[model samples]
Target: MNSSTHLDLAFTALADPTRRAILARLSEGEATVAELARPFSISQPAVSRHLKILEQAGLITTAVDAQRRPRRLEAQGLAELSGWIERLRESWGYNFRRLDQLLAETAPALEPERTGS
Candidate 1:
């Protein structure tokens, strides 16, 4: 798990479609800047800029492979995002259970009393 601010940064990084696409590409495996940018019609520098943001957010990491810098997905970042989402889901589950209990408890109160009809 990570701090809220870091999680926020990761969320912000994922907000851009290009960055998201970049992450999606990294998910498959590691690739150099040129390889990553090949699918898009943007310049290599443009891709680098997006990669910088992703790297800052801890979503991706770069490795120096001789003449190339290969980028790959970071597990810690993915885990942090997954942890936040799981917490949210658990909280919603608790809330729904409480609501169900409340509804069940109130059902009898709304029923009319049956006389000797």
Candidate 2:
């Protein structure tokens, strides 16, 4: 996928709580579609759909083994996600610091006059 499409898929895949939970489960170890579906109240097909989204996002992979297809988490896409978040955080952090400095510099000028007559 192109970079923008990859990011769009990654964020959209993560937007659902079920998919996020699936990612968390996969983080522990690889699991079959049935195994992943077991914890949730949703049907196996629904879980399969979530897996498909994750796979399309490049967040997970599956391999066919006998009767089961085991899904495993892939780190590269997650690393890219983390990098994007960190860069945004850093940019905002710097801007906030600059704002704080400007506020500090202007504070004295905004002080009200104290007069006794």
Candidate 3:
């Protein structure tokens, strides 16, 4: 999928607190659905639904191991999201610098009005 689609999926998945918690758990290590469900009050099936969304967003992956399927975090989706955020941060940084410069330039003119000049 393209970058925008991938980002959309990642953000949508991340919009849920439970899904974010799931990702946080996976970041520490891979886990089964049961392990993932233990921290929350929700049922295992509900946790599984969250897992499905995360997997679809490309934020995680599952591995088959006998009777269990363990899920782990996938870096590619997160990397894309981080990169997009970095770009936005840089743009905002530039804008802030320009704003500071503008205020500095206008400061002297405003001083006279403050003195009732």
Candidate 4:
């Protein structure tokens, strides 16, 4: 998928609080659907649904170990998101710097406020 597509998936997957919590849980280590569902009062099936969305977004991946499927965070997905955000931050920083320079250049021309006697 293209960068925009990937970003769209990632953002969509991140839109849910439950999915974000699932990701947080996986950050510590891999977990089964049941384990992931422990924090929330939701059922395992619901957790699995959230997991499915996360998997589609490439934010998480599942590993098969016998009967159990454990899910873990996929670093690359987050890295892609972070990289995109960083680029925007850099662009904004450049714009802010130019604005600062313009203000500095025009500072002297602005008259100082006079105190009312």
TM-score, each model?
0.89, 0.90, 0.91, 0.92
lDDT of every predicted structure (CA atoms): 0.93, 0.94, 0.94, 0.94
Would you give me the overall lDDT of model 3? Answer: 0.94
Give residue 3's lDDT in candidate 3 (0 to 100).
Answer: 88
Per-residue lDDT for 1-117 in model 4, tens only?
Answer: 999999999999999999999998888999999899998988989988999999999899999999999999999999999999999999999999999999999988896988999
Structural RMSD, model 3: 2.3
Prediction 1 global C-alpha lDDT = 0.93
Candidate with best TM-score: 4
| Cα lDDT, model 3, residue 95 | 100
Candidate rank order under TM-score: 4, 3, 2, 1
lDDT of 4 at 80: 96
Off by over 4 Å in 4: 113-117
lDDT of 2 by residue, 1-112 (tens): 7888999999999999999999999999999998899999999999999999999999999888898789999899899899999999999999999999999999999999
Q: Report the lDDT of model 3 for residue 94.
A: 100
Report the C-alpha displacement of residue 19, candidate 2, in angstroms. Answer: 0.6
Output the better candidate (1/3) by lDDT: 3
Off by over 4 Å in 1: 112-117
C-alpha RMSD in Å of predicted model 1 compared with the true structure: 2.1
